[model samples]
Target chain A: MRSNSLTADLQPINKNIRKRFVLSRLHSLAGIVPLGIFMVEHLLTNSTALLGREKYNEQIHLIQSIPFLPLLEIFLVAIPLIFHAGYGIYLSMISKSNTQTYKYERNRLFFFQRVTGITTLVFIIYHVWSFRLAPVFYGTEINFDLVNSHLENVFVFSFYVIGVVGAVFHFSNGIRTGLITWGVTKGPASQRIAQRICLLFFAVFGVLGVTSLFAFI
Target chain B: MSAEKVIRLKVKRKDQMDSESYWEEFAIPYRPNMNVISALMEIQRNPVNAEGTKVRSVAWEYNCLEEVCGACSMRINGKVRQACSTLVEKLEQPIQLEPMETFPVEKDLVVDRQRMFDALQKIKGWIPIDGTYAMGSGPLISSREQQEAYKFSTCMTCGCCLDACPNVNSGSPFIGPQALAQTKYFNMHPTGKLTKNERLEVVIGDEGISNCGNSQNCVEVCPKDIPLTTALAELNHEANRYALWSWLKK
Candidate 1:
């Protein structure tokens, strides 16, 4: 009889089982923590536009003037977002969406999570580049006028709407998924309750996001 | 014997570990009501290829001629199933046999299922009895709970569910459905509930219940017709409550 050592060599080592477990848990958490919180803060800050250009620019200046703002962004927003997005891409690559065969609502929602992840990633990259970096690179005034002028273009307006919708959906749906995946909400009843709460999140954020867009107008 | 009818079979064969696998066709004397395993036995007896060339007998694994052992699971005509129960007569001609893909192929139709065992181990898939000393009888297990658990008890550790699951591939740590369902099975027992928290830690961990992609493929491919997805959902709920309780305790 052949020894099983030969078989052992063929098996791939799951070296990161512990690390992957921690990281996967953290991935779901990162979305809800600072990233989701930041989305709300960003939308609310932008909504200051409803108070007039002076108030909107003041809010921007206030945010920009916070002590150790760069460090805070790096720690809370940048690192968490990068880890969440990177791990999410790895998961999406390995995941085989089987909505056609399964056709369950949760299965469809799972598929959409990946879909929205990809779109949100693109939107985030473009959003940060145009609004944050472009101003620095061009030495343009970082004020309400600069933002409003960009939004005046129909193309930019459409892109912002799409980005907002994708981000809102990703965040809201992500909370529900994260809850289930983390074993926070286990059964159908709890999952349904979580879904309702998530839907409420979607509705609330949808209103805030759209209202924020109008502020730019 | 009425001019022996021949059954056509194509078996995926690999000579050794880390070797390229190739298909070999065999023409075996067909027997009425013979299953895939019977046809394989014929190939072993003759050791001749359909091309009329002499060859080594195909290697495969089976103990119970019945499906209860789960040792004879292989892909029959592109579907993962137990060869012992898969009747050759009911199958399409030129029956195709391949090993389950979720595990590493050892040789021919045999594959190493250490991964499945490891998953079972990770979940601690057994009830912990206090001691071997004469305890006349254990606590009464309710018939309702017994009925619910009986469905999970039928899991033969067959890789059918894992083989069908899209998440249990080489790159993934998802523990697959077989083990998850087994965790639920063990967790439901009164004796099994003692070590329940130990199992919950693994259940909520990386390779645990959360990795389920909700595809429902495992339920579809399970030979025993185990309600795998339902088991997962219930266990997932249990795991959540357990996790929250643990956190609050801390």
Candidate 2:
């Protein structure tokens, strides 16, 4: 039955469907690197808003005015977002029927990876809907000044606190898991590092969230 | 000789997947010879707790009632081990039984272990035959090879290796140590060699063997004491050879 053929069966599946799944994971990973880019860009944008709100508003217009920005976002950012999240969910489920994984590390990581994926998925959906899509659909302002001037009420600040905290968890976990996916870290160091990173992730994000929430409250 | 006294047990209980997890405590009449599983079985027969309440018996997994099946593995005194082998005499009073942390709690002790099974599937951890087409007993193996292969084949996928491994967790895609060892086991077979390259490729990939951190806990927790590190080390050699060979071919 080739029941012992752990190496045999993986060779011959049609590549197209397989490719899509692969592409999907690649997309999920793509979001991580760009997420870093987004964080930097966002911090820079928000710093100006905190300064006077006018500079932040001007900064947003100037950035959006760059050539083919929306086109780049649609292809590079948006498409990858949909594929990566969807594909990772699929891959995690797909491995279930194939192996009797008996190690601690695999099961633990796979479980949390799925959980964080789902969390990030839900959070991203909410963030995009509230900030990005809402501005277009509600025909309201999209500039940074509006968010700081009127929208910076306690409720909005609370959301930001929660939102940033969620983003931080997702980012750090995504980075750690991404390394595992790309095959970095080894042995006790890896384990120690993963633990450290998780604790670090939680602590940093928790502090940021609590501080931010308290500042507004 | 002084008689070994009773030890308390607060066992987490469940029946099947989708069942709720609960706890019950029992103070069994202790015998020096009593193992945790035997104690549990005794409790099962009695169905009475230390509080004198009639309750549903605790449910856990076991087979080979000898710790070979890895089914009886759970946290004993807050550490993971086989109940059949966990002697009551060695433990402190009030020993606790908790499910292994790495798997989804299917009921009380049984988890949906299909994840580990799927990893084995990913590596195909097998020797492909031409579909039982009247193939006779295929190849010869030396006693040394037989002995080594026998050791690895003893792996019952009990997940002790995974539980002890750091690379394995819910957040990463690493395939853990057992499957990587299985890859070498099959790769060692003369017939299995046909797929050695295939296994090597998988183990070398992202969720594959390259993710191993070599904490060596996998070896310590393995009831069979399979040399998982040795297997992984050998696989690493093979992976390098395969990569080099492919480069030469290019």
Candidate 3:
């Protein structure tokens, strides 16, 4: 008779078994610690446009004038964002969305989280390239005038609108799931409360982001 | 003649493993207080289709006639649940029954749930006591711990959690939520603590806790109401600590 023990079928644990866990933890940490904080700061800086062009340009000039500013951005913001985006794309590829079958609120949010992650990835790449990188290479000043002129085009404005909302949603929803992933919120009740708080975060940041765009035009 | 009442069932049937699947409709005489298992039993008894033609008897597995065995799990009305617990009265007409797609179908509603069993093996979901001989009374556990552990102890190895999980498909290497919860259950025992790191090894492996996509669907569809997502989260924390400690030691 065949043995009922399934030890033979089990995959042997390898020496590098911790690799995926380490990478996954790093991915979740990178999203909240650096990228999420940077997003909030970026939106707050842009919202200074509501105070008029001079206030906005002053904020940009203040940031650009900081000592070792390039080094700070590269080490803290750019590297973390790249790692988060790269791992996020791989995760989104492997996940199969079953919201149609399991129509729970959290399940739907899970699907949207992946969708927004990809959307935010693309938007960040284009936004950074055009506004930050292009200005550096071309020696063009990043001021209220550059952003205002760019947003004057309806299509560019619309893209920014979608991009801002998507990025904010991704960041806010990442907090909701990341709390659970890191064991900060383990039970359902705590998780539900976390969900509400994250939604509030999304609403506030979303408004600030979109309103900042309007300030640009 | 008075109109006859009937319970309509649309069953997805298969002849054998790796055979083409097809649908067969059955009209069974209405019976009060019948569950899905009894409905399938009616089809098995008469072996007749809705067209009044005889055909092969429908095949399914059921034991204990209760939800505890977990043998009669299938998708009823697009939901993965125990057929023994789902009543006919709660279902709409022409109830759709299909084998869970996560596991390979052996025939009709029966699936090869060996993957779930294999996962239990992978996690070493059992206490490692030295011998069958009488050991002294084990270390006493507080009722508080028992109450906390009891929630995870009720897992019947039902595949509903796996069926609803988006990450537990054929191509994915995930060990699913069932085994992860069982790992938590066994680790709560006094004797089980001896092999805790052994189980953590599996939890930190490639097909381990990291594979869970945090969709929380496993918790939603679980028949036992097992706190699967919570277990996954807690295990994620435990595994991370373990991994960090091992790295520091080296």
Q: What are the fnat scores of the candidates, in the order listed?
A: 0.27, 0.05, 0.64
Candidates sorted by DockQ, best first: 3, 1, 2
lDDT string, candidate 1, B194-214, tens digits: 877777777777777767766
Best candidate according to TM-score: 3
- Residue-wise C-alpha lDDT for candidate 3, range A1-217, written one tens digit per residue: 5467634354555667667878888999999998899889999999999999999999998998889988989988999988988988888777788888789988888899888888888888889998999999999989999998889999989989999999999989989888877878888889889989999999999999999999988
Q: What is the TM-score of chain B alone in each candidate?
A: 0.94, 0.88, 0.96
Ranking by TM-score: 3, 1, 2
**Candidates 1 and 2, the one with greater TM-score:** 1
**DockQ of every candidate:** 0.18, 0.05, 0.61
- Give each model's whole-structure lDDT: 0.81, 0.68, 0.88
Positional deviation of residue A99's Cα in model 2 after best superposition, in angstroms: 22
Estimate, for each residue in A1-217, the C-alpha lDDT of model 2 and write its tens digit.
Answer: 3365334356442334234324534554576766545653654455564445567678878887989987877876677777777765755554431112334553454455556667667767877887678888988887754454434577666656666666666566566655544435433456457757776866765565455334322
In model 1, pairs of residues that clash are A186-B237
Candidate 3 similarity to native, TM-score: 0.95
Best by DockQ: 3
Error of 2 at A113 (Å): 5.6
Docking class of 3: medium
Off by over 4 Å in 1: A1-20, A32-77, A90-116, A139-176, A182-217, B1-9, B26-35, B38-50, B76-79, B85-95, B130-132, B172-175, B204-216, B233-250
Measured by lDDT, the strongest candidate is 3
Q: How many Å off is the CA of B40 in candidate 2?
A: 5.7
